[model samples]
Target: MANPTACLLIIGNEVLSGRTRDANLQFLATRLGELGIPLREVRVIPDVEATIVATVNEVRAKYDHVFTTGGIGPTHDDITSECVAKAFGVPWVVHEETRALMAEDYARRDPPVEMNAARMRMATLPLGAVPIRCAMTSAPGFTMGNVHVMAGVPRIMQSMFEALAPSLTGGVPVVSRAVHAIGVFEGNIAEALEAIQKRHPDLDIGSYPFYRPTPGSTGFPGGGVALVSKGVSLAEVEEATAEITAMLAAMGATPIQGEPG
Candidate 1:
């Protein structure tokens, strides 16, 4: 059976404009990998309403789960909640519990303040969606169908995701292994690597090159291709990695158990 799949929809004008570098995709991908939900794709778009709606609907329909980050804050530019609501044809409404939580949190601050419209905006959500709680900021995210809207801030987004994680069911976690070799050229090993991949089609094998800065030396460090594998079965991943190691040994390159740190 196929494993549960997820897609990330990153929304923010700052991200598109290069003002704010995104940090959520890698975090979510790693967490989901541990949970066995493979993140199949990622799309980064601006805060455009129509584009967000279209993309949210597309990915939500195609994948088992859809995660959205950014554009859910209190500012005017934060429009992901509304776009996601539009995508699902749902009316956006104020989640009363979230509003109350925000109100209480604001009231408890050292400089007690009113829950103004701007702050209240954080409590709004698409009607019928369940709130994804955020302990740090009283402003919470929400879940609509397969779509999960989260905060743009890395810290708050992480908190909201933790709240929603227990509710999500995941498939068997993929077993991951890596076989590395130092100073082995990709061009020289391409043929052997292709044969090994063909032999173990079930494994998700990836070859990545690494670099290390040697100040005194002019050349890139003995960095080489890493043959990483992921599969439902540990034995299969290990077997494929072993074959790659054997291939490297035959080609006079020592295969290391892990990549260079």
Candidate 2:
């Protein structure tokens, strides 16, 4: 099956300045993987209109799907919608549906909904775009020309992504299983692990090492290693997991069945 290609654009000065660590990339990456979509590239840009527009246009032209996170909040710095509109060469205006949603949400507050101009700005959208609503936030997202505009807030972005999953074109789901090795560092078994990965070119094999209190020791987490394999077929993951597990055991190490909780 053909893999559905996607590119991610993270727009925020907070993330770039190290003020906030991005959570959307990992969330979207795993979620897309589950839906059989492989993320091809990711870019992080400051909340600048010119840069956002350029990156949006670039990714939309290159990938089957382009997902953007951040810069959609109800603040002056938020400009993703306008930038997207400009990139698509479409008119930008206050979207009535989004305004209604925002108004209704604001009405639920202790005080009556204040129709402030800044809050109203959150309702603007690009011309000929579809509204992407979410329960997490009232600011609606938009989809135009394969570009999906989502919220800067991680929760709202995730909700929008979930709602839009049905519209995405994806390939076979990627399935994976992990094998754990106790008392063995990653380097000791790196050669065998690399061999298994080489033998299965179609499968993606990864080795992750963790140091924690020892498993058998009380209050002290165990430090161990994990081998994970992902592919289009469950059988492929299972086969790779089995082979790698056997290899680790033969090297005088204990291969645990699953990754530690």
Candidate 3:
């Protein structure tokens, strides 16, 4: 079966401006890949409601599944919940379960539970959305339609993703075997590699080259090339791998299978 296609929308000014590095994209991508789900695209946008809603609607319409991260906090920029609600034309209200979870977390904190209004804001969700729980954090994420909303924090986002994992459908996960070529540059095999890619369009073909002092036959200092091809179709991946290996051999480059260097 072909892997289910998915897209990710990362919402936050911090991530857009580099104030916060976007870790959630890679985390979710890895997790989804493990489940045989292919991530098609990823977009990072500000916390503005219009942008969030537009992106959510666009991605949700295109992919089998959509995920969002960030802007679900208690601060003013935290408008993801409301934006999602607006996108679906549903009422945004405080979900009881999330409120309970937040309340519990507040109770366990050092200062004790204050039940402040700002903290309680974390409980809001779009109507009919199913809550995706995070054991690492109090703010419960939620799923509505094809869109799954998760927290911005890495640990919290991971837990929420795990909670939602079982519900996703997937095919055989894409598996990859990389080959490294020392004492040669990518230019040496560029034409053959491009031919292989054209032959196996379904597979993801990538070539990475590292710079190092040219080593003699002793393998002291030498640059290398890394070739990686990944895909759900085992036959296609294997075929591409064989072609890549053959190309490397033609260039007299030793093919070291797996991770580069």
Candidate 4:
């Protein structure tokens, strides 16, 4: 069978408006990659229920797993849990396991936390969903069907992922190799790179230029470009890497193995 695929839905008006910089996507992407699950699509949407509902339904249907972050807090703008329930045609209710955890957490506080309507909202989840909790925070995240809803906070989300990853089985991990040439220009190597890419269609090859501290310092607009090749097969990666290195050498530019930064 093929590797598992996933989609990430980032929910929040703040993230979309740039008020709050998103930190969960990259964290999740790296963790998922390590687990051998390729995260194929990522969408950042507002707090609108309809948009959330539609996006959740769409990606969940397309991928083996769906992960959503943010908007699960107590504020009115926190609407992800309800929206997910609507998407899955399940009822959103205060989950007993989560509530018990919340109770235990607050009971130990110097000034015990209150489980008011606002605070109680944190314990709510879609019916039949399982909770994901860890030392990062007691505020639980839930997994409903193929969709796993998580906290937006990087630390908490990472902890939740650690707790959940072991249960999932993954295929062979995708491998990546990057080569940087200090004095090479992408324009000079574009055609060669394109040909190499065509020859290895299964690989994902990319070129990224690094700008010099002072423009035209080396008479080149940018310092150099890094050629990166990514794929699952070890032999294919090595073959593409060798081709890229040879091409750079032929052009009188030394291919520096690995990324610049």
**Cα RMSDs of all predictions?**
1.3, 3.0, 3.0, 1.7
Better of 3 and 4 by TM-score: 4
Which TM-score value belongs to model 3? 0.90
Ranking of predictions according to TM-score:
1, 4, 3, 2
Once all C-alphas are superposed, what RMSD does model 1 give against the true structure? Answer: 1.3
TM-score, candidate 2, is 0.90
- Candidate 3, overall lDDT? 0.85
C-alpha lDDT (0 to 100) for residue 194 of candidate 3: 88
Better of 1 and 3 by lDDT: 1
Better model by lDDT: candidate 2 vs candidate 3? 2
Deviation of model 2 at 212, angstroms: 2.4
For candidate 1, write residues 38-74 as lDDT tens digits: 8999999998999998898888889999999999877
lDDT of 2 at 65: 92
Itemize residue pairs with steric clashes in candidate 2: 70-152, 212-221, 213-220, 213-221, 213-222, 214-221, 214-222, 215-222
Model 1, which residues run further than 4 Å from truth? 216-221
lDDT of 4 by residue, 38-60 (tens): 89999999999999999999999
TM-score of each: 0.96, 0.90, 0.90, 0.94
C-alpha RMSD (angstroms) for model 2: 3.0
